[model samples]
Target chain A: MNSVYEGAIQDLIDELGQLPGVGPKSAQRIAFHIMEAETEDVERLRAALAAVKTRVKHCETCGNLAEGEQCSICLDPRRDQSTICVIEQAPDVQAIERTHAYRGLYHVLGGAIDPIRGIGPEQLRIRQLLARLQNSEVKEIVIATDPNIEGEATATYLARMLETMNIPTSRLALGLPVGGDLEYADEITLSRAFEGRRIM
Target chain B: MNSVYEGAIQDLIDELGQLPGVGPKSAQRIAFHIMEAETEDVERLRAALAAVKTRVKHCETCGNLAEGEQCSICLDPRRDQSTICVIEQAPDVQAIERTHAYRGLYHVLGGAIDPIRGIGPEQLRIRQLLARLQNSEVKEIVIATDPNIEGEATATYLARMLETMNIPTSRLALGLPVGGDLEYADEITLSRAFEGRRIM
Candidate 1:
């Protein structure tokens, strides 16, 4: 295996191992799979990789990922401008869209506030979000951050900031899942953390 | 996000999803990870993907993956010439080498004789193996096929074929694993199974 191709395979494995959950074993498996893949398929991935760096850009107003000056949601007239759902990333916007529950625009914050990772409010698109809130036509802002600790802290910080700006803000409700068990709930969970609780 | 990299992420995700064990979620994760990766790292993977096809070749004698005209094992003089251990694939050769117990030469058959898959003995490198046996210096031939239905049938066929050539052959011992429980043994097991057998 100590051949000219060994270095290339090792390099691929190293690159693949950098992924969030991919370990050395998984990286090796993925590298081998890629090696066995068709040339056209590999070219597609290569083209996509190059294209991401060259084509994708942040929307000027809502901070959502867009191919042009603004995201599709911001440009669409059918979407409600009065209600903007704020999220941590572009993928979150896609997740919400998949449900078809919110017929409103979205604001991607890029990431949640994580003191440990040195991610501050200023580093996010919080200022742009505030600018959007300045419009009197925008009646409500929905904080749809993740239910995790960092997400909660960011949401709380944003909510406090919005309150100072005289903007009515709301967060995504959380409690037991639709078919969850109370016994499995942690201490902070069963307390009905969200103010509004509906009996099923 | 369609800023500059319009459908690049989607295209990469689709390509990654085509892998054997990777799903859509994993593919998305991988695509994002690759996006965040450095250009050099991505280029390394691309180079490696191409190198495997250009550099690697099948060994003329054993049919195992090789870097040159023949595999390293086939060229090494320290390995015993009189004994050849037959395996199913190149990876199998690596697995055996990891044990450090076998110092003999090897013969990779490419794949097992699977009738359902239309692979017969003629399709494999069995002819090359017989040619190697014709040399009078060869003494023992070890059948190290996997312990499965197809493997068993292939080994039995090879054994019957070798018996006609007046050569002493042997099969790897099979039984309970070290520190394994008897209760977990299946039907084929716990019967004709060895009790505290010693390796020769």
Candidate 2:
């Protein structure tokens, strides 16, 4: 039987398929799930989707997403201004916060330096970060880009740029996964394992 | 600096993460993509999602998703009422339609009989289907359930139930993937391969 819902369902699948990692099969599954979901649940998602753009804005100081002029992290007086964790995106800030591992300010680059994607240093918030550093309040900068090639390149680029300012820079540690088998380690991982070896 | 968008962005990530196959990383990526998308594009998705339930109905005869009292296949004069292609879900109907291989009517089982899930013949549209068969001119029944264990069990159960009637029944052919290696074929597949072997 021809369904009037056919076109709407197909459109939903197409829109969902646009998302990263959502293949057509997965998109169709999600579309059905959404269709079967409670009206209130679907409406919540729709309202959330619309509210995000209207309510959210970039933090004036950190470029992180915020509701007002200052983000929650920047407004929290207990946070350390002497150190700033530089990341590639706003969600990275949340990832760090979830761990409760660090209580410093954050600088979101919005994206990394991918010349192939036409993203250069100027396109990022690097200049603004540098300007913030010039005030001399931040003594240490943690370059926590992802461990992938692009992330490593971005960190390296930032490290060199911050060198002139004489701010101490560090990258996140990399090695084998915890409880991972040594035999399964690739050559690059084995090299990193050796490079990060301790005297203990 | 704090971002004004942080809370709303995080909310969107959380919502997207609830979808099937969408991991935390993928959810974050999708949230950002939605944020950057054209307002109208996102609204189209929202509208489609909202419209599916409001506009779509189930066909009284076939159980397929429909716009009006009956589905298109049920209403189409060209479709054969003398034969019925029974499938597990609405999307399966679309999958068959895409091939343009069958012009017979459809009967959506809603789901297969799974004792583990507490779903029996009564839970599905089996009663309605039997009622239709009693009154209609159906000569053949095509049990096109998925090739999985539950599908097989459901088909067997239905075949036994339909044994009381005089209509003939058939199942879709199943074997190996088209380009897959025979050496990698599972035991069940190998058994099917031998069982369906040609005389030539």
Most accurate candidate by TM-score: 2
lDDT tens digits by residue: candidate 1, A81-169: 88889999877877888777899888889899999999999999988887776644888889999999999999999999989877889
- Tens digits of per-residue lDDT, candidate 1, B1-200, equal 23222366677777777766677788777777776677777776666666765666677888766668887788889988888898886667767886779989888886788999999999888999998777547788899998888888889989999999988889887787668899898766665376536678
Which residue ranges in model 1 land beyond 4 Å of their true spot?
A1-8, A181-187, A193-196, B1-6, B179-200
Please give the range of 10 consecutive residues that has the lowest summed lDDT in model 1 chain A.
A1-10
- DockQ, candidate 1, comes to 0.41
User: Per-prediction interface RMSD?
Assistant: 4.1, 3.7
Q: TM-score of model 2's chain A, to 2 decimals? A: 0.88
Question: In terms of lDDT, which candidate is strongest?
Answer: 2
